[model samples]
Structure formats: C-alpha cells, structure tokens
Target: MDTSQHSMHNLFEQLGLPSSEHDVEQFIRTHRLFSQDIRLDKATFWTESQAEFLREAFEEDSDWCEVVDELDSRLRS
Candidate 1:
C-alpha cells in the first residue's frame, strides 16, 4: 500500500487532533459546519491557528492539502 495514502486517511491527526479513526469520526459527528456555503477554514469548530494552518496548506498546495481537503469534505458531508 502507498504509505502516503495511508497518512492521508488520518486527517484528524494531520489537523492536530486524535489520530484514531473512531476519534476522527466522533469529532466530525459532533462538529457543525458554520454554514453550507462556508469553507472548512471558516468553520466554527476550529481554533484560529487550526484555521490558519488549513488555509495555508490549501493555498500552498502542500502535501497536507489532500488530507485537509478530505477533512473538509467529510465535515461538510
């Protein structure tokens, strides 16, 4: 298996949250998106630093972008 893909699956950990899949799912389940039209970086659940990290990762198109996008998709879903 590609290890990079495996790492992408741990989106919560990439965002400095618990690494476990269960914890990640629980966190997603509990958090609400600020609005359906709002981006993940604008979501109310994250701290300012967390939001900044996400915005930077996305703007830079860094390796973390995929995971961050995944988290955004999951959260919005």
Candidate 2:
C-alpha cells in the first residue's frame, strides 16, 4: 500500500479545483462538512464531476482513496 501523501496538484485536480497550494488550502478552509451527517461526496461545494470522482475513488479503493478519505474526514471534522 502506498502510504505517502499525494501531491497537492493531484488532489486539487481531482477535486476540480485549481492546482495550487494556496488554492488548496483556501478551499479546505472554505468548505466545511455539511450538517445532518452528510458525506463529502454529497457536499454541495463540489461540482458534479468532483463529487463523482470522490465517490468513485472511495468505492473503488483506488490509489487516490487514501487522500479522498483524508479529505472526507478533514472536511467532516
């Protein structure tokens, strides 16, 4: 299992955001977990494509899964 953190560019790209460190940080700060136990995949902030990417990454347990899980937990918290 590759436990290393992926690049911010990859994460941002997958999320359909600009691939920049500042943007990534700003995005994380701006978006919080929705109330009512909503999943990250259901977050309103994401575009349809971004949401689908997250859902697929999680369901498929792909290489991006760990990062997706991390993002999910962080946003929820």
Candidate 3:
C-alpha cells in the first residue's frame, strides 16, 4: 500500500477503529451528526458509527439509531 493509505490504516487501528479508506470516508461524511467540525478524512476519523448506534439503541431502539446503523453498514459495504 502507498504510504498515505498505510498511514491512514495504522492511525485507525491504533485507535481501535475502522481504517479502510471507504469506511473512513463514510464515517467522516457522517461526522457532522456528532461534532461541530466539518473536516474529515481517512487520516482523522476514529470513532465507530456502529458503536455509536448501539449506544443510542440502548436508550431504546429509535428510528434514528436504525437509520444510523443502516447508513454506516451501507458505507462499509
């Protein structure tokens, strides 16, 4: 892999997060749901949307969580 991809991959693995370029890009695109920052990419996204969905699901399975999971899953595929 190129250094850029390797660097992005290592960073996510270190954080115990998904690191594939596609997944990372997806997570970054949806990050506005969690933070004020708009800038995101494979190099900076670390949080797992699936984990986030599960946490919110604990509050009771809402449509929002379902949508979130579906969105993330779609991106992962």
Name the top TM-score candidate: 2
Clash pairs (backbone) in predicted model 1: none
Judge candidate 1 at residue 12 and give its lDDT: 61
Superposed on all Cα atoms, model 1 deviates from the true structure by an RMSD in Å of 3.3
How does each model score on lDDT?
Answer: 0.76, 0.79, 0.47
The TM-score, computed over Cα atoms with residue i paired to residue i, of candidate 1 is 0.77
TM-score of each: 0.77, 0.79, 0.34
Residue 35's lDDT within candidate 2 is 80
lDDT (Cα, tens digit) per residue for candidate 2, span 1-77: 77766765788886667878787777778887768478788888888998898899889988888778877776766
- Ranking of predictions according to lDDT: 2, 1, 3
lDDT digits (tens) for residues 1-77 of candidate 1: 33465354465665678867678778878885746789888877788988998899899987778878877777777
Which residue runs does candidate 3 get wrong by more than 4 Å? Answer: 1-6, 33-77
Error of 1 at 72 (Å): 0.8
The lDDT of model 3 is 0.47
What would the per-residue lDDT of candidate 3 be over residues 1-77, giving only the tens digit for each residue? 33232244554454466889886676557653443342222213435663553456436755344444454344444
Which run of 10 residues does model 2 get worst, by summed lDDT? 1-10
